[model samples]
Target chain A: MPACPKCQGLIQETDAFCGHCGNPLAATDPDRREDVFDVLTPTLAYYFITLLLLGIYKLTSVFPEGFEGIIVITAIDVAIVIAFWGNYFQSLRPLFSLRGLSLKVMAFTIVGAMVGSVVVSVVAKWINLSIQDDVFYSTYMFQDTAYPFLFSTLFIAVQPAIFEEVAFRGFLFDNLLKVTPGKSTVYVTGFVFAIIHLNIISLLWLVPLGLALGFLRGRYNTLWYGMVAHFTYNFSLTVFEFLSWF
Target chain B: METSSVDSSAETLACENCQAVNSATQKFCSQCSFPIGGTKNEQIAFRSNIAVRTRMLKESERHVSICKKLLYFLAGINLLLGLYFGFAADDFPSMISSICVALLFLILTAWADRNPFGAILTAFIVYLTLNVVNIIDNPALLSRGIPSKIICTVLFVGGIRSARQVTLQREALEKLKAPGIGNR
Candidate 1:
């Protein structure tokens, strides 16, 4: 009649460790939680390697130019199109709970992003730092190429809304908790998530974003909270860029 | 280190809730079914497994992009050779060969439109064709080489960069669709 405390799976009263999750249940001790700093280094390093390999492959080819670059970049637009489909899967994915989504979570996500961005904006202002010169529009390529408003919208909004949420919130945050038991995982995972951006200049802003996303992930137990927040963050930038306000 | 020391002792001492004992090595509480310890190592092993599977998935998605790039590189080479023969041979046969290479390049481009790497190769072939055209116009076209070289450099570098992003995004999307297995 006992439920396995580890996974909430049904387990016989005679079992010591959870047969399903392998969690040690007999010991009257606190569960050992692996620090996020410990697990993060490898994951972040792997991410760097991924970026390096991708950059090398991208820079070496001879292809899109003039109007062609637009076409090729539009190929990236394919990701946003798929992001639309991800919405459907989000509801159906059993592991991800949608029930936690409430008005409070939505408000928290927006407030978190806004607060994070404002802090970042202030820090950059304090340091007299400039926005990354050639990041969005790379210098070597896409110089004359205009990233159209629509494409930019897709790039900023849907792409990060889906991908970053899935990676930082849904995957990393969830997985880290298995090692580092307890609610404190939200903080540890947040720090690691910020580090993965690998842009120190934006670290101040990114850290809060990480914290907010992690909070939402834990609070709602749903990936949608993070996704919605990420979308809002990106969409704000898009609006700022559109208005030439930044 | 101190925290872990404190944690282990606390677990051994705390008896707020009673659960059936399984064994010293056993991880689960027999009656209450609560995990007692050693969750970190287990999660690491599980995540490592996930990482390996994700790597395999990524490699599979990259297969198409790798093929397209190689094809593009080959098309560029063929187009260049055909152009060289056209000028050196100075005959109708040479011109026909050049035209044939150009036609082949076009076919490759059409095929590549749906593929990222193919598009890049097609662009290179076009850039080379421009050079071939210039050479045909001036048999001794050494002076115009500098300008042609610049165009080729831009086309080649820019095309690949664009294609790579496109392919990466495609792969990311594909990965997101595939459900995480073994978690259940």
Candidate 2:
């Protein structure tokens, strides 16, 4: 015999409810409880931290240059990913399992990324022709230096591919599926992903990209395929820019 | 102590815990001090009655109150916007629509406590219709329209959850009232 957790009344192992207090014993069941860093918690934490960092960026003006600001923000995002998922490494292991990471899905994601990139570029061009502003191009264009191509590949392509996938697909996507039912989880996650970018002009492209990534993550149940797709999209942009295709 | 009985031929009730025979009118057993004559079904029914009362109280105090507050808040915002557009901006069509929608939301809020499902359904229909008309009139409202659509989706989902809960509560109450059910 053991004491009930709520009222400390004597209870038998077979009992489903406390005899003395009549409290349901199901609340004490381990399977019913969720971890502190569930999907919603991390998603919310990411936004709260990002907003706080944005406020700091505005107030302090510590990183005056745009590139430096991006780097600092990316660093903060990485820190958030680590802080939230660090303790629950065991639970996250199943999300990255080898059985779920199929080569077919990987190839599909790569093709999807290529098609998505082309579509985005065409849309961006059309919008640019109408507006004649080239907001994205002017914002992301790096100075033509000796190592400009390498710099773009490292920071713009690889860094975001790894870090963003880890945060969105690996951490947030996996946890969201646990809480939400059906394909809506993917859409909701994508919505949050796009909103965090905080750029109205980019939303036109980012939202679709996010949805595609979310779909892949849910379909394959692994983050690696998403990383490949994201990397290819970013790297292709860098290559296209180097070739003066845009 | 003297061994006395109300009557030798009178009915005797047994205690559930100790099985001690006692008078039918006695509430507790003399031997075990446990409540007599109350069967397990009666206890279950008693507990369910308490649960139903508590759930009803909670639904009214928390869920319904929250829905009413949110409706009123949205109504207040719309009213302020209507006044601004009517007086300051001088946009008559927009102002009139805003005022009408505001009044509708306020009425829905007042009705929510009595008829939650109706209020929620009406509010959703009115809001969606208004937004659809406004969007048709001005396509440029698309940028601002997405956020409102998202909010309405959330409200719709909340309404669905509330409806499910109310349905479950109503079913439980009906079961409690059924003859020969949970009667021991």
Candidate 3:
């Protein structure tokens, strides 16, 4: 009749190991209410590495000029995308389903991304103005090119759209479902997504952008909508980023 | 990190939580670290203890990260100021050194996640060394940014404290892994 204190699995006095969980049965300590952290380690490690890489990328300015720099940056993003699908191939395969995806959802999500980007742009401008820092925007490889819009959209909008969705909505959000209940999972994923961007100044818009992407992925149960939204958002900002140079 | 689904079978092992099913050859769930076949309460308790330690380590990580962000901002400012002054005199040494220092801070910020205490301690030493060198060059240098300098010093000191906590938490977690841990 005595229960194992550890996992609450039933154990007979004669059995040394718990039949349910296989834990060794022990006497003495009363069962205390237990809590759970509710995450698998690999996912946590991925997020941690992502933050470190993004932070280092932000602070270090030693990349070769122009398009070469874009190649270097995008290489890391591509590798991360590979890792996301490689490590969790079976788990992430489900997010690729088009069950709830529709033209209306894609259109709505794209509109949301555009509106979100504008809000972010305005908030970013306000922050720059208020801080009086002039907020150096590094054009990097996107500068002085014959095809600034092409390079920016390819390197910035398209690449990040695919990569970020896979990393966050596909890998992280799916994994988070194992830990958290349905309601808060999206926002939690969004919060983590925002933090990884490493731009405190744009957090006002970044958080919203993150939430919108999370919502798209969560609502429709597909990465395509989120990808469309993400691409739209970044592409819109790419326009804004290049607007002043001309 | 690899997770594969297994159809329910007599030969397969199951995890209590996380829903991870493992082959009979596996002793723990690869995805969740849950023990397989048979587990002891002590193992669960041990993982729980480790989870707590991991949380503590993350809080410390947040501290060093803030310190890292502060370094980022200061390094940018230093690089800009160095270029400005160096350009006025056409002296490239200060500019080169400033860039080197900025790069060093960036590397330290990346390393901070892995070893918060060591990275922050090294960063603190470098920061203090820079301030001392500047003060020696011109005693009046201290007067210009006293408030800002004080804030940086306080934040660095707090970062160091958090790094120490990280070390302690890590050690405790390591001890929990020693042989006879779950046996006890």
Candidate 3 per-residue lDDT over residues A1-246, each given as its tens digit: 667566775434444334455454434111222122234356656765665454444455555545776677678767877876797888778788767568876777778778877776676675554311222223445667887778777887888788888988988788766534444567657756765564444445566778878887777788898888888977787787777511
User: How accurate locally, in lDDT, is each candidate?
Assistant: 0.51, 0.60, 0.63
Q: A1-246 in candidate 2: lDDT tens per residue? A: 577687786554544444445445543331233442333455555655654554455435555556556666667767876787785677777766677466776787788888877777678777664211322222243554456777678777787788778777776666656544437557656755664553445557786888888888887677778889989988776676666564
What's each prediction's TM-score? 0.41, 0.55, 0.48
Ranking by TM-score: 2, 3, 1
How would you encode candidate 1's per-residue C-alpha lDDT over A152-232 as one tens digit per residue? 666557766776666656545554554344354565456555544434345456657777778777766778877877887
Give residue B19's lDDT in candidate 2 (0 to 100): 44
Over the stretch B14-65, how does candidate 2's per-residue lDDT look in tens digits?
5454444555665434332333445667556655664765567357345545
Candidate 3 chain B minimal-lDDT segment of 10 residues: B175-184
Q: Name the lDDT of candidate 3.
A: 0.63
What number of backbone clashes does candidate 1 have, counting pairs of residues 3 or more apart or in separate chains? 18
Q: Which 10 consecutive positions of candidate 1 chain A have the poorest summed lDDT?
A: A133-142
Q: Which candidate number would show the highest TM-score if scored against the true structure?
A: 2
List DockQ, one per candidate, in order. 0.08, 0.06, 0.04
**Global CA lDDT of candidate 2, please?**
0.60
